[model samples]
Target: MWKYLKIVLALCGFILNTMILHTNPINDVTNLISIIEKLRPLHKKLGKPGPHDWLAHHHEPGQTFQEYYKSNPMTPRGKRCVIYIQPLGEFTQVQRRIVVLTSDFMSRFYNLQVKVQKDIPLSVIPNKARRRHPEWGVEQILTSYILNDILKPKLPADAAAYIALTISDLWPGRGWNFVFGQASLRERVGVWSIYRNGNPAESENSFRLCLLRTIKTAVHEIGHMFSMSHCVKYECCMCGSNHREEADRRPLWFCPECMAKVCWATCSDPVDRYQILAEFCEEHGFNNEKEFYKKSIAKLES
Candidate 1:
């Protein structure tokens, strides 16, 4: 039964990838294979997804390095070198600090400059775009409106991608309760809410946890903007997430396959990137995360 299920899932993934990616087939993939091979031993293989996990529910074929290269994926180059973060609403001092830290970390992660834009008042979201959840009664903001109407129009000419960060809760549309965030591959615009990241002012641990979550979401969304698909091959930041618990379970680092894409997309040096990432994690008390990055760097340098 499990073997048959695996075949069915593989077929579903192939079909979905063909439909959505739509890039010319790649050939002479030797270099790509070499890169994946070199980094493979440094990463962990993904276990089967749980019954309610993202992969269990949605079939997605992970993108290969050559496929991404041939897809005319958005790379940071020329004028499109800056990542712009648009502030959507007011935030507490701690929340504001989280936003600032997120921007800084994003700059280092993608090796692209990041700029936080002037704050856009929450009042800009009209009654039509705001809601109160019927059951939970939590105030929510419409994600589509922000992506299409707000950020798209105002996206900077020099932006590699424009992202919005907000304190207000987010709901994608009808039939959903809430979302941590959402992004557009074609539009170069995305938005995420830190409302669900937990209040940072509560305690030191909570603050660190909130920062880690925010950084993960920020970088993951931007990865999508680069036309990188969910990673099916390993436990990775690019893997699709089904819920908060599942997302938290995923690491803050990219798997070998996804790392290759990021390195290629940003034209970054893998060793240097790992070193800086480790330093950031260590400074913020993410000891385990710090050690993992350090190990990756050592393996790469060796």
Candidate 2:
């Protein structure tokens, strides 16, 4: 089953790549390049990574706007533009609210329509695909099972990406412990666990933290689905993280280069995008992030 699934995924990637190559360049390429240049100084360069940081453990060449365009990266095109979110399993009132807000943020982030599907019960998972952590005694469902057996089979025809949002803990396989999320760039299927994102019912601060983490992971994985490599150029949300501290340290907004990629891919106006993002941050009390987006708008418009 695994082998067959792998072959199918590879074939899907090849077809997608072929489509990208034949697709015409985005009409606003020059405008996006200008926007990147305009906002360049406002973005900060990524510094040396700590020993436990993602970059320290994994070497990524990083993707620049030019490289991304030249490679004919995937974008939401034709009927495959909507991002679909499938909730798998139960959620507390707080967690459910967080998921709703995250979906709204994703819509604004990508400038695409987002649909939250009805819940798919956890009963679908079988015994072979679940385990209890030997050391921690925590229950976790197999991420591969969710990605392959569940998400891939039901992926909506109009979905550019179909992601499962779950409150259950997730494990990729035996060698690993737990993953916050996993995504198949080729298959456009992903599953994320909010079990480790902290209990949102704790306090207002905790709720905000949980929401921030959820938003970060959602956009990050979806960004991967768009053929975006990890951002090594700046302290952008696209930058990879190995742990919670590193993820928390990263900003919610993309850097100038990455911002351009999102704009070009979505055919969004940079100023308008920043404005909408800033409003979301303000509404959600993300004061710091709000200020950053506002500043980005200023830089671009200046």
**Predictions in order: lDDT:** 0.84, 0.87
Summarize candidate 2's per-residue lDDT along 1-302 as a digit string, tens digits.
99999989878886885466334254266777787888888788999999989899889999998888677676787668899999999888889999899999999999899999999999999999999999999999999999999998898988989999998989999777877788876778988888888989999999999999999999988988888889999999999888889988999999888887787788777788889999999999999999999888888767
Estimated TM-score for each candidate: 0.87, 0.89
TM-score of 1: 0.87
**Steric clash pairs (candidate 2):** none
Q: In model 2, which runs have C-alpha deviations exceeding 4 angstroms?
A: 1-27
Clashing pairs in 1: none
Compared with the true structure, the alpha-carbon lDDT of candidate 1 equals 0.84
Instruction: Estimate candidate 2's alpha-carbon lDDT, on a 0 to 1 scale.
Output: 0.87
Q: Which 10 consecutive residues of model 1 have the lowest summed lDDT?
A: 20-29
Candidate 1 displacement at residue 243 in angstroms: 1.1
